[model samples]
Target: MTGGRTGWARVPAPVRDAGLVAVAVGDAWLAVSDSSWPEAGLAALACAALALRRYVPLVVVLLTVPATVVADLVVAPLAALFALAERRHDRRLLGACAVLMAAASAAPWPWHDPDSRDRTWTLIQFAYTLAGTAAPVLFGQLVQARRDLSRRLAEIEEAREHERALHAQAVLARERAQLAREMHDVVSHQVSLIAVQAGALQVGAKDTDAREAARTIRSLSVATLDELRNMVTLLRASGGRATELTPQPTLADIRKLVATSGIDAELTGVLPDTVSTPAQRAIYRTVQEALTNVRKHAPGAGATVELWCEGDDVGVTVTNGRPTRPSLPLPGSRQGLVGLRERAEILHGTFSCGPTPDGGYGVSVRIPAQPA
Candidate 1:
């Protein structure tokens, strides 16, 4: 039954109206008493009025009344009453239209004197016609009710989906807060101890190699602690509350980054003042990641960090020489380069990394002065 209704609804409105007009015209032709002009004209008018039923339903119903009384028409008037009932919410108005339609259907054409028997039979026919009019009006009201119910159900479902989304976000915020606490309480404490021990070893060790190794460990541990503190701050701020964030790195910080990188590196060149903050951050991260990779993979290699501007583009290039010693095996997710590429794409820029011709590694990134 639902499929049948869906198929019927897919029919074009004008086509449906044309079909109803055709049905009404056919009923009028079969029921009219004679080929007289008055009767035939009224029947034609009633059928034609069905075309306007959806827009002016009450007017259409009234237009059909003359044809009903004159030519004993049934389909045209009933169809008009159904249309009015479907669109109108006033019960009194619908009741009045239904009564008018029944009266028209039962009345005699060309009024004349009648006997008692004729009057009694007319009364019986009037009651039967009144009962028949009820069917179309009731059915139209039922269809209206079903339409409202369907809309209400859709609204209810949408509200439920929104509530589910909010609940999921709350759960995620709580989990982030818990993770932040664990990093601060346990992970941060452990890394702090490691940094302290490495510092002490660097101070006490007499062998040149041992002191250098301890110094390198201490430097790496301090960097790790700084990053962990930043992460914890961000995670704890995830619950829609405002908090001051740690200042982000920019182009001005590039020189300091190179100095602290613990590798022999040179910094040169200047970017334009027109470079956007995000673009600056991208360039800073590029140099930082490149230098870190050199320390890990190209041990004892010297690096060059160059910042340059050409036309409307500003960029950074970090290139390192081949390692002087074999690099120790280190666990890595290998996501650093992938992340740099994604960031460049977001800023409508370009990033490239590969081995240099001098048996060294190179990382370069160029971004627009004003990103889109």
Candidate 2:
């Protein structure tokens, strides 16, 4: 990757090379400032050799070795050794550079003077040279290791992020499928009623306009049913049928539900003839589920169904008396109430079911006139 403006771009290879050249020139000038003509020439040659250190580091170090004997031109050898260690991990090259630096450091002292050529002084010079050479090599290896570790960590984080995104997509797909199935149930039930009413109109209507209207309603219902079937096909992978073609229960069907429940049940409500289809369906299902629960859990108890409309909202409450007989050990899927609650909430309605103050179970729902 290319460097960004405020980041790694600040230190390009050309700029780094230029800085190294400047350091080499400064060191050479210091060494030749008060030396003989031969020493000055050698210093200039050593500084020139430093220019090639980044390209052929070993060759440049070898070239600078001769000049160090005449003047202390350490920049070329030190820079070359650092570059070699950073770019190559060959132990032989490092050992060769260390030996060369030791010779150069000892060359600077006056060996002809017996006092200065003592064992202690020679050993000290060799130690200093070895330290200078070894420090740069160790630092370069550390930098390389750090870069490798950082790259590995970045790869791991990227993989984890990809996995998280895939999981979120899978969840979204599942939710959409569930919504489609629920929609098919509700829409199919309402459309079937429209088809039934249109059939009745076709049989009873006297005028031409009324008959035509009934025919049109039947056609529309059939077309809607076809579309709903197609939607279900696309949403589900393998389900028997998208929706039931048979008639579904509505508010008008509550009487039938109560009679078949077998429990002592009481239902009282005054739903408007023009109530919205969704509201009627919700009321019907809530009562039917409550009656079923009463039969399963309270075998012989009485239950009451109360429904009331206040302003723009309609409410239904189903309550049962304490069990009169022993409860049945019926196996329950346990998803009935949860699904009902989800259905109400999706339509911007409220549903709640729990134990009543009278030591019996109660289920209640309040729905808006128009869904949001």
Candidate 3:
């Protein structure tokens, strides 16, 4: 491409030179009548000016316009047209050159013969003509250059935005994988315990503690499943990674959950079974904590867990019937209910708690689930 451009640039030089020689010869013939200066000297200077028109156009104008004045003060002065084309940048110079050229063209008729002077001032016409000819071409070049620069800047900004987005996505993916890994480690280990206990109970049906442990394992497993589902939903909705979105058992799953808690309490679920895991986990956790509460608040009262996954969502109620007496120090995390609400909020779910009409503590959750 460079070589091709070089070749093209070379092609114009010879043509320009030939055109210059032609203009100088034509101007010289017209000027010879003036005989104001030696012909050889004038011709040499004119030839040089014409030849160098492309590069030193101002100089060409300086030399040639005065020469044209001598040669065609009345006929057809011409050097300023080339001047207008070459040095368009200096308006002041352009005006001066224009006035001189026009004066030269019209001068011969007046300076040589007053009766022949029709118009010794055609510079106004020439000036107007020059502006009209150059404005659009120069304006177009300027506009094109601006547009090209704007387009390149826009492209660069878009590339930067794309790179930033890709980088953010990569970071999110890495964090998601890390979260999933952590969840898998925690929940899978819990499930493994449940499965192993089930296997143990199945193998030794005669052991009471094993049976109880098996039941506990079942409760733990059910709760674990619900908690895992809730955890996943949270991970996903929060832009973490819920790619494996699945319905989590809500209050409806608590009966099975508590039945597996290894405690001697009746776990009931009056609510529908389509409970979402976040809700179910909330309820399960409530019962789990209530049981823990019972162990601390009233270890001797028999406990009953009733879950209602009905209406807008699920409700969990735990009553220990006055707990038989007061005690201290629960066997589990004391912040269970707080954690439950925290979990619910994480899922964009709602939670409520207080005493039920029957005097038992009631925990209610309204999440994304069909009523019973």
lDDT of 3 by residue, 1-372 (tens): 111344544678778577657776765666575574554455556566666665776676677655554553211224324434444555566556656555544444225433323333354545554454344334534544555677788889899999999878877765664354345433543454454446446456787887787767666665665566566545544343222224444454566656664445776657555655555555555666566544444545566776655446556666765445444221222234554565556556677777656544555555555322
Clashing pairs in 2: none
Highest TM-score model number? 1
Model 1 pairs whose backbones collide: none
Model 2 residue runs over 4 Å out of place are 1-13, 29-71, 87-124, 145-164, 196-211, 230-372
- For candidate 1, report its TM-score: 0.56
Residue 202 alpha-carbon offset, candidate 2, angstroms: 4.6
- Kindly list the per-residue Cα lDDT of model 2 for residues 1-372, writing each as its tens digit: 112354554688777777787898898888778888877786777677667766887777777776676777667667767766766678787777768766775664333654545767767877887788777777766755666677777888899999999877676666655655555545554564465457558768999899999989977876776677677556644332222222556678888777666668998887776666777777777887677677667756799998888888887899998987675333343444755676577567899999988789999998886655
| TM-scores of the candidates in the order shown | 0.56, 0.48, 0.40
RMSD of each: 14.7, 12.7, 11.0
Steric collisions counted per model: 0, 0, 9
Candidate 1: stretches off by over 4 Å: 1-7, 33-35, 112-122, 202-215, 239-372
Highest-scoring model, lDDT = 1
Residue-level error in angstroms, candidate 3, position 150: 5.0
Summarize candidate 1's per-residue lDDT along 273-328 as a digit string, tens digits: 77888788778878877876776678779999999898888899999999998764
